[model samples]
Target: MPSRSRYDVVIVGGGHNGLVAAAYLAGAGRRVAVLERLDAAGGAAVSGTPFPGVAARLSRFAYLVSLLPRRVVQDLGLRLELRRRPFASYTPTVRDGAPTGLLVGDGEERVRTSFTRLTGDEREYVAWRAFYARTGRLAGRVFPTLTEPLPSRAELRARVADEAVWSAVFERPLGETVEETFADDLVRGVVLTDALIGTFAHAHDPSLAQNRCFLYHVIGQGSGDWDVPVGGMGAVTGALLEAAVAAGAEIATGHEVTGIATDGRGAEVAWRTDAGEGVLGAGTVLVNASPSELARLLGEPGPPAPEGSQLKVNMLLRRLPALRDPAVDPREAFAGTFHVAEGYAELETAYREAAAGRPPTVPPSEVYCHSLTDPTILSPALAADGYHTMTLFGLHTPARLFSGDPADRERTRERLVADALAALDTHLAEPLADCLAVDADGRPCLEVRTPGDLEDELRLPGGHIFHGDLAFPHRAEEGEPADQAERWGVATGHRNVLLCGAGAVRGGGVSGVGGHNAAMAVLGR
Candidate 1:
């Protein structure tokens, strides 16, 4: 090994979380450095020129941004340039020869009725809101104390006192809860779909009721608005990178970290950069990659097995689909997020198929046309000239490709894209085939993602987006022992090393809480 040059801290993976941690540590007058495997800072939250003249988000994976803590943004001074707009989701159902379903209002309305479909009654919307308010207050009592080392015995007792709040909330399955709460099937279905996203659980499954509460815990309620960052989701990370740089943090990209060397007091990280072998030493090391990726960086036998599974697909479209909704103005369609699951059974069946490692014949998908919301992110005037760039997220798709062969993977990708387009057609009735933008050679338009590609290329464990399950074991829930929180946050059996990725805490989305909390722990603050 070369001579070790020490710093106050070292963060692994330039994903938003790692960047967030580095920024906070640097803000506190500590010398910090961030190491990213990819050439860019943002991992999934990025926009790039994959093809010449085509700049789009790599996965367009994350669409909504309500759960993120505003305190982090304000502390980092990121609110100045960050642009956001209120967007609501639409769940369409064909009734009396016309489509109709509940349109969840932004913020508290969204949170209150998140599980409305499962409740089966509109009246349950109020109950759902009540549940969120109760749970959030309980969470506040615990989460602030969870950012550091394990809580003391007294702290654990105080946090658990709030556990009684969830007693009535977790009494029923999410589907049952919704049915008992709402008289509307469409509303129940919409809420159930939200609970099942990125997981294998069915709506009727026991112990899944808490999943709805879990989802609400992360959502922003006070403002009650689900907004997309201006420019693109990439802009969020770009702003974070800028903030880190301003805070005196150094970032090195395209430098893949191969291994982590650690002792009780400090650590040495090895990476392969263009400049040949590079090593950095520091008293603290934070890993922002998925749990599995982090384990791989530590070599085999690193950490526990990953929890749950995830699959994502992104498409570059030639034009926007003409959906049948008077409320869906062409401009607002992209401004809002759309869900394809019509009912609870539909969402349940999709999750069942995904759990069985088989692709659903009609997969539930979430489609976002960024050009519809922000024209600036696309090539010149794509949104203005009646052309828009779109991305489709097929939730709960098979993590394993049907066939091990490369040809089979390609076929599966086509099937998934076709299913998403077909689902979009049900609501839009637009001929997606008419507008085709192909390569110079004039081939059919293509969708860009494969299960095999995500697992084999992106190194995602079972293609899970959050890198791990967001269940209690992985999440920072109250009543848990202090040692458990430490294991969940930074310490992973390796001394002087830590974890700061989505897998560590909130377990997905662009929220930098995990990163910020990890930095606080390492700094002994």
Candidate 2:
């Protein structure tokens, strides 16, 4: 028999978003509890001793922290722990023995130059920045109101009508947007690459214009600095958990939520822990799992299924091979991150192949070598020996495992690893195999979550990470009441139950807008 306890609210999932919601609700004088299936609270934003004596972050799944709102950190007083380093990235253009045109930078100069090199048009870089600047200002205005009910269409159009904002929002595909603005193919590819990061769409695709909006929503302003915290990405989650604890929020790890019991008054959440089945009732429930996961919790009688993209792989690496770009100084090599796909055409082709349920020969890979910037992440002993840890995000692999007998899936996993290594090899002269420490064997470091699995297990529709796409209709345009209910934020179709995971309007990443906004909504703030 499980002990029955009551609370003002019960938050499911100890992911960053869930912890953020718990902290805010607890701060506001509510008795709250947080339950996590995993023993730890960070979810994807977690770090572990995958290898002995190695403290490398598992940043492969969720790399970079710049997209996180500064306001959220400040409001929560996590400044000291959430350290920021300069943004760094490099692409070495070497042909034969000579250097072609290596691109590198740390601030707006980097953003501008990266785009300029891609399209060969400085004007295009200017337009892109101007567009991003205006969008940032608009986000500042609109995002604050996200916790409230959706806005009106008139308000959305009025905000979008601003000449600068309108151009970026409606008139451009990220590829064409950059192409029209710049003449450099390299710059165009690099700048537009941001628009396609986690999506199955191509840079040149018409639907990509909305992706640009979502991209800018994350790419903060000024210097374009995407820094990692000191200890590791997990530090951010640790701070949130600390805040929650300080606010008197109770947390239980290794406890899996099995179902949600709803009634006129509120919801009764059931879970299976080490002890046994446990249930807690609350006036409001905030779910941090995917929409499909939530649906499973509600059984067959809950809200309609959610629709969105699913996350594929999250691999941790020991070391990244040294990439030498003659145009870049050795010191500047670690300044930012790198996009490995050669150009827009390659990117589009790769996405097309993946969409057909086939893994692309050349998958789009995003590499983040955080240890180069954050010394703390390096093991103290290894730091003395000068060994650096890197995170290679082999994103957008085919959702389906290769079809075959049991042995085929195993071979498929090997092929996926080979594909990832091959992609890295093509970009850098010295591939990861040369500097390798840990190799992915057996199952994939992380398998792609199927839509059915997302619904049945994680409870996310389409296994989409953002709950839903962060495009125009989903955002309900600029002035409209934010129709992110499907995304799973503060607003739920139900009266008291609220959504607070990456599935919400602001959407995924380490940002806590989903949770913070939900808290405010619950308090009717």
Candidate 3:
């Protein structure tokens, strides 16, 4: 049945952010409704058993959780858990006859030994740690501000309080910073990769979108760690759903919100459910949709269509692949982020090619074996069989490259996947394809998500994962509600409707900053 035709707040899009907002608002004793277009919630933070006759549930889209705030978890009393990976990353040079490249974490001696090859001395490694130490401090200062009223950029820079740190990160191009800081080209490329993950810009793009993206990737929980959720990505969302329901939030799945209007008086939402169309009246509307989608719902012009530049590949490996470096076990190499063909110079080359209307010749991507860190993701049968799930996030392959006719798009996807797999082969002792788990159909258990695929699946405008290019977290002006400094930074130019999704300020990842901020904005907290 439909909700009471009215609510204190109607949250459109039952993504994790929406659910977070619903929980906060409902917990405050407000009547709330969360309408999800899909039959279930979670958005990209979902898990599913993609392979038939196989019981392993793969975290379909997003595979890691880092930005979710500890405060939110504690405040909501969520039982969600996240497991840390001891090995941070291993970069495998695709060059033949070259060693297995570099791996960070595991042991300080091994990591320092790897760094000596790149740094030639401890000076460079010292500099690397110093650089992140400064950024880590900055992350600590900035993360707490995310859910509060917008702070001026000057205030934020002042809070960090170091001119050199501010200039190197916020002012100088990230490319220049990495080049100046790291002596090794591959090491520099590894640092810059964080800047380019899903961003389509070069490290030196004048817009500094790369810098912002890099900052977000590095500054999670003030530790710069991207941890694996205890179960899968679904665990985070499942907990959010649980918290919201416990707080008296009504969630209606399969309810696709189609229209929204807001005035000084209140907000109205129209949706298409399985039964029929319905309109909801609410004192306020919290939108978990992308900014472009929200703009369309509000009958306004959307931003320039954003584009997603990543190709994600998910596979169930029959067993861990053999590593080229005999000294390092496959368990340690694959546990954290595994990089392939991601040397700095190569990254630049791939970015230039993709920018020049082509997919990367050597497709730069990262892979991680999730089961290595958390065995709970696998069923007992699969666990006994030594099967593990791996996720690959391919960078710089823009959506525009797949913009041709249908057949051409498919061809591009196939070529990209083939090239990516071929690159991953360079670091393995044996071909990775040989280790792929066979599905019921006798085919390899694999799935590739192109930028177009993300668009179709998640309604991510242009498949842009962060909704759009990340904007600076603060408003330009200081201390003025009229100037947007006093708003929770969730305001959508609508008095009573606000954005609580990746498009909102400080929004992205599985973080509920937008959700928390929106609720705070409504509650005058």
Task: Please provide, for model 1 over 1-525, each residue's C-alpha lDDT reduced to its tens digit, 9 standing for 90 to 100.
Answer: 222367778888888888888889888888887877676778777765444445444335465565556778888988423445545665666666765444554566554454354344456667556645664665555444434445544554456475454443334565665676555656566556656555656766775633643444334533334565677768888889999989988888877888887776778888787778778888878888777776677775655644333345454567666567654454455556577764667777777776776778787876666665566766565444565666666666655644567677777777877786777677775666665455444654444654455556556676666675564423345555344326345657665667787766544666787787677666663
Cα RMSD of all models vs. native, in order, equals: 4.5, 4.5, 1.6
Superposed model 2: Cα runs more than 4 Å off: 1-4, 53-57, 83-88, 93-102, 106-153, 156-161, 170-173, 204-213, 216-224, 301-320, 401-407, 438-463, 471-489
Per-prediction TM-score? 0.83, 0.83, 0.97
Clashes of each: 17, 46, 1
- Superposition error at 43 for model 1 (Å): 0.8
Candidate 1 vs candidate 2: which has greater lDDT? Answer: 1
RMSD of 3: 1.6
- Cα lDDT of model 3 by residue, 1-525, tens digit: 345999999999999999999999999999999999999999999999888888888999998987888989999999898988989988765334657467799677878887766446777667777887888888888877776777778788887788887887788888888877878777887888888878998878889989889988888887889999989999999999999999999999999999998784688899997788889899989899898999899899988999888999999999999987766788988998888888888888999999999989999999999999888889999999999999999999999999989999999999999999999887788999999998888888899898888888789999999898987777767756762314778877777888888988889888998898888888883
Order by lDDT, highest first: 3, 1, 2
Error of 3 at 386 (Å): 0.9
Pick the lDDT winner.
Answer: 3
Q: Give the runs in model 1 whose Cα sits over 4 Å from its true position.
A: 1-4, 54-59, 79-87, 105-165, 168-172, 206-218, 221-224, 303-311, 316-319, 325-334, 401-403, 435-446, 473-488
Better of 1 and 3 by lDDT: 3
Q: What is the lDDT of residue 490 in candidate 1?
A: 60
